[model samples]
Target: MTTRTIALVFHRLRPNAIALARDVAAWAQQSGCKVVCDESDVDAIAQGGHSHLTASSSFRDADLLVSVGGDGTMLRAVHSLNGTLVPVMGVNVGLLGYLTNVEPEMALGALDQWLRGTEGTSFHYDDRMMLRVSIQNGSTKQSWLALNEVVLEKQQSGHTVRLGVDIDGTHFVTYSADGLIIATPTGSTAYALSARGPVLSPRLNALLMTPVSPHMMFDRSLVLDPREEVIVEVMGQRPVEIAIDGVAVHTLLAGDRVSVLAATERARLLRFNDNRFHQILRSKFGLADR
Candidate 1:
């Protein structure tokens, strides 16, 4: 029998999350499986003399990567994977765990089932689409991946930044607004939803563009084909801040441009059951069946 490897990725600040990771590590060791953690989180998970856990800079070889926090932690795990095909299991320790598959109490059971294979257990992979974003400033260029939306907003408060939009190399419109959000179907329920953007099925292959507090009357979101590429150019004098998956990463000056499109790689989430999207949405929002 071949040895299996399980990687634990958790929110370092949460003591409960850390404790749960340690428990999972101990369980994996007892089950004759290798337990590892990201190098950045090794110290935290190795605390209290839990020295058996291995520290790995890469999780490409891990059979499974378990996220022991909320949706944000899951997003962090996906970003850390960097397009690796490793399957991620999410155990919710925070509120609103839309991305998580199970609760903390069921984590070990779920892991056991996953280890046992699908012969007698109900386990599957839920692949979700991701987005790739590129920024160009003169000769310097940078790129990042986002499981959620990529935001380009005004850098300074009380000022609206002007951004020019283009689709497939054709100029679209120029907007004076607080920001613009380019989101994948998986991100429809996130910040885009808060901005009044339409909710799309996570299984759909599409992109959503929503404007934030636009000065113009055309403020509705535009859902575009996944194959289409969107370009947002910085217009006027004010600089704009760029955020990937809600984390601020770069600042673009006037004349800089950002390109967004569906990534070729998808995030593989481990799931035990086939839960419908509308059902999950209704449960998440406490929507009553009238």
Candidate 2:
């Protein structure tokens, strides 16, 4: 008998995702694998009833952590891992799942290959980024780590503001626009793409700076090397909002400076050899499979 421990994490808010988690857990258990999961998942399925599930708010030890949801849930799982070296596998519950790609039907088959040591493997480590954020009239002290992009925009629509972007203490440009987006390669396909930013390959070491509805069409997107540090200084008297990885929101005032740079940590996403980055991209974006 083979012994492998796996952590099954999922978004409890979605019924389909929860059901899929239960299925994966049940199958792993019957196949002689240990499954650490949340109680809600176990309770949802009769086969997973009375499972040795860990509490939702607590930690469980496992060799692999499985996330069942879309990209949002994957980010939550990354935070939950909290620097653990354990790799995470995503089972996309819905369409347009940028992070979650493995379909529900393919999950068990993939798991079988993974446990049998017959699967190909790759590393899709997270590119952590740093953020220097401040509130209006506040000290330049608030900072953050972002796995995706950071967005600065007007709190209310139909308003324009002046934003100065500086790179390494030099003036890059000033934009009179609705907002700006600073995204990592991993985040290029997200809100940044919707704002007209180019899609960056995941392995590329670069940052994408895109302006949202700039007053000047000349304010096209800018791609910078990963080593560069960016600072966004507000230049007008208007209420602005900052969103980090779509998880936290902060208010910024004119004269406040938001700095962004690469972070020290990396998010480890377990990848099997069968998983192809370009393939996933083409499938999601409807590009030619070739």
Candidate 3:
């Protein structure tokens, strides 16, 4: 029999999550399928006597990678995959289950369907767009990926930031606000939504420029075509912190320019026929129809 392979990633490997991973692993192994996980997760699981897992250093060639956590875990899994385009399945253990496919109780069944190829036949995939951010500080340039959004915020507390925003090399606006958020369509419901940015369809190939608590009149979010690259320059001799996907990664000194563009690759997300984006929004956020 041919050995099918599946990779597992965990959020924190709590008992419940560990049990789910083990259950999924055991089931896959029953049919001579290969179960692998990154060394980090393997070490975590080894402490609990589930060390029969293959310690993989990468997600390349994974038949399917399961993330038994929340949206953050899903994002991390995708980031680790690093443009490999591997299909990711998420089990929700966080507050917002936006990126997760199923709950912990449903994880085993979900994996069973995929492994058997019968119940999983109808499951589809959505290629969610991601952002490629490049920051230039003098001759040094650093690039990063953000599955959600990229924010340029002031380093000093209680002090606002000034960013000169441009689109496709044309001057647009200078934002006098707490910070600025450049969000992908998949991120519309995240930080952007709370800052009054309009919600975009998940399938839309677009980006949003939303100012965070602007003191000037041009405060409305601007929706731009996916082809356009956004440029934000740190102004006013003040340094700003750069946040990618909610974590502060670096601080941009004055005279730095950050460019954000749609990545050539997209995140392949696993979605079952039973799961729908609209339904999740209503269930998670209590969005009732009038």
Q: Which candidate achieves the best lDDT against the true structure?
A: 1
Cα lDDT tens digits, model 3, 117-172, are 65347577788999999987668889988888999988887888899988999999
TM-score of each: 0.97, 0.83, 0.93
> In candidate 3, which residue ranges exceed 4 Å CA deviation?
118-120
Report the error of model 2 at residue 92, Å: 1.2
Each prediction's RMSD to truth:
1.4, 3.6, 1.9
Q: Could you tell me how far off, in angstroms, the CA of residue 119 lies in candidate 3 after the best superposition?
A: 9.5
lDDT of 1 by residue, 3-22 (tens): 99998899888999999988
Q: Worst lDDT window (10 residues) for model 2?
A: 122-131
The digit string of per-residue lDDT tens for model 2 on 79-175 reads 6665555667888886688777578888888777667764344233333343333343454466665667888888777899889989988997899
Question: Clashing pairs in model 2?
Answer: 120-273, 121-273
Q: Rank the candidates by TM-score, best first.
A: 1, 3, 2
Q: Which stretches of candidate 1 lie over 4 Å from their true place?
A: 119-121
Model 2, global lDDT: 0.75
